[model samples]
Target: MVKEIERKLPVVHVCTIVPISQTVGANRIVPAIAIPHPLGDPTKTEEEEKVIRRRLVEKALRALQTEITEQTVFTD
Candidate 1:
């Protein structure tokens, strides 16, 4: 579903805690939040979660400026 969109348009995915190896099966991968919550887990401490979310979001922003044509996974 996501890969299809990237193929047709310019798209970047946010993969926070997603392992690079696991993303292989998918058509494309982006650096986002953790697996359970791609935007940050609500169960964690607010300070901790906010810090992690900020870092991941930063990476996603960086990826958006690149000219990648393959499955690119950003790291934090």
Candidate 2:
């Protein structure tokens, strides 16, 4: 589980719904695209989708490196 892993290592919860993540005690959260396509957008070209996914991944990476005392949502 995310909370279990987070006890030792930082975990970034990338989900379409932020409220649910918070309810489950996700300290590091990243707002995703959608439920069906959390990391990709079907409306965009393949290359564009890749770029969007890359940015999302980068945000998660940043969240991992950040130090927080309370629940934090990283949005950029």
Candidate 3:
């Protein structure tokens, strides 16, 4: 489904629980926190979590804008 979607769309950013972006064959991947809480860490304070989430979102947006021929992983 991901490959098919990529074929139709100009850009697609994928967020994964583990470091399986390459294994899954995603062209653009944003490394998420985890499987259950992909956006937040329970150990972090609310403010810190918010910052982390924002940064991840920004990275995803940048991945969408960047041009690449091969699979790429965006990290903090």
Candidate 4:
């Protein structure tokens, strides 16, 4: 799906989690917290979770702005 989207919209940024990113051959990726909770950790307080989510969003935005010749993984 990501590839298809990219093929149709070359300027659009596509990013996914780690292992799936590898599997799908995604060129842009952001490390996730986990499969079940990719953006938030259940064990964390609401404030902490918000911070985590914000960081992930920031990483994704950065990924979209970056230019790369190959696959790239953005981490916090």
Number of the predicted model whose lDDT against the real structure is largest: 2
Return whichever of 2 and 3 wins on TM-score.
2
Clashing pairs in 1: 13-30, 14-31, 14-32, 15-30, 15-31, 15-32, 16-32
lDDT of 2 by residue, 1-76 (tens): 7789899988999999999999999999999999999999999999999999999999999999999999999997
Give the worst 10-residue stretch by lDDT in candidate 1.
20-29
Candidate 3 per-residue C-alpha lDDT over 1-76 given as tens digits, one digit per residue, 9 for 90 to 100: 6676888785555465535657767788888887788888889999999998898888888988999889887765
TM-score of each: 0.59, 0.96, 0.79, 0.82
Whole-model lDDT per candidate: 0.63, 0.95, 0.77, 0.72
**What RMSD does each model have against the real structure?**
3.6, 0.6, 2.0, 2.6
Question: How do all the candidates rank in terms of lDDT, highest first?
Answer: 2, 3, 4, 1
Q: What TM-score quantifies how close candidate 4 is to the native fold? A: 0.82
Model 2 stretches with alpha carbons more than 4 Å out: none
TM-score computed on alpha carbons, candidate 2:
0.96
Write the number of the candidate with greater lDDT, choosing between 1 and 4. Answer: 4
Q: What pairs collide in candidate 3?
A: none
TM-score ranking, best first: 2, 4, 3, 1
**Candidate 4 error regions (>4 Å):** 10-17
Q: Residue 15 CA error for candidate 1 (Å)?
A: 4.0
- lDDT of each residue in 7-64, candidate 1, tens digit only: 6766565554546534533333555645768878788899999997787666666777
Relative to the true structure, candidate 3 reaches a TM of 0.79
